[model samples]
Target: MTDTTGAGGPQDHESDGPTGPVIRDKRRIDPETGQVRDVSAEQVQETAAEQVAGGDNAFGGGVGDALPGGEQDPSGAPQATSGTPVDGGRSADDLHPDTVVAADRLEDLRRLQAEYVNYKRRVDRDRVRDREAGTTTVVEALLPVLDDLHMAKEHGELTEGPLLAIADKLETTLGRFGVERLGAVGETFDPAVHEALMHLPEADLPEGATETTIVQVMQPGFKVGDRVVRAARVAVADPA
Candidate 1:
């Protein structure tokens, strides 16, 4: 009989195996009645499994052992696609993707919220400042008018009629913006808020006066919020 062992087709012999190099003889000389080497399904399956596993069928070791590449991934992890399980079971991590931490996500959300809160506070502060500045400018321009109104009222020129009503409404409007008059007779006068044009004798000072006192307000001063629009022009009398 002619030796026709591997004549059937290609043989499954892994030249490289774990432990050492593997040599499979495909000769046609059977111990019983050797002619052509016969290939069995069981032998084929065993050989294929060994080759797929790579090293020891145990792990043959792949991230996805026997899955796909059956080789190591970029992270140095043995990678394998979905396939028959290797000799040993693979860890869950090897089968799935990475896990995301909820704490990290929450921290990021809180940080963004804090940043928005700070921005809102800053904007509110700027808005208040702008409003105060606008009020101060308007009050400064109306200082002379306010003085005329005060003088007229004291002289009984605005005791009644539309002029008195108009003055009252104007003053009321300015008051809403925190505008107020400065300087009054007998009030302690300070250089920061009072412009003194004349100084009377100490003898003319009001009773119990310890500091410079305003005896006459020639022109009333006005202010908006904490900003002085104009200083009070007045005559003063020093303490005895």
Candidate 2:
């Protein structure tokens, strides 16, 4: 065999064979700067990660020093605040949407509560008035019977046993219900409580007689509490 391989001659190497398609770098380059300005996807991703890592320190130093209030840290970043913001730098008008909604609902509830209280008070007052009105009506209807009893007593019919006792008991029961008799002879006449059926001139007036005095009580009046149920029919004596 002929020994053609010699030292310093063309070295035996692997043959260049057909392989997979090569990737092309088609990044845009600035014509003015001859430097490779285009960055790889890996480099861009790394830069983005760095920016994100330093994001928390953005307000730490330069911008923080320029701000008015609060303390700063050694790294030029603003120090962590001890407490939360009171109103989150918002005024009453600039409150959060959820906060405003909650406040509005609370106000509505308070208004409804007030309205309910007023309604309840009105209902209670009306109930009391209705009860008084019903009682007054019944008492008024029974006035004729009372008048008959008064007439019988004046004629000495109710002077004795059962009838007098029954009248007394009825009067006591009515008194318990706040019913009261009004108007008496020799009392001061009042337009509010008494109705003058006739006027008389006083020649010799009694003690405490005034310009308007009740000389005679023709019919007694009835009242319950401060409410007058019936006016007294009376004769008034005018001082002559």
- The whole-model C-alpha lDDT of candidate 1 against the native structure comes to 0.77
Give the Cα-based TM-score of candidate 1 against the true structure. 0.55
Residue pairs in clash, model 1:
5-37, 30-34, 62-78, 63-78, 63-79, 64-80, 67-81, 68-81
Q: Which tens-of-lDDT digit does each residue in 1-240 have in candidate 2?
A: 122244443333453432333454544676577566767798778767877777635565556555434656677655545331335654345557998789999999999999999999999999878877776887799899877887787678998999899999988888877788888877778899999999877434577665688877677899877789899998888776
Q: What is the alpha-carbon lDDT of model 2 when measured against the actual structure?
A: 0.74
Off by over 4 Å in 1: 1-101
Q: Which segments of model 2 are wrong by more than 4 Å?
A: 1-101, 202-205, 225-227
For all candidates in order, the CA lDDT equals 0.77, 0.74
Q: What is the TM-score of each candidate against the true structure?
A: 0.55, 0.55
- Per residue, candidate 1 scores C-alpha lDDT tens digits across 138-176 of 887887789899899768899999999999999899999
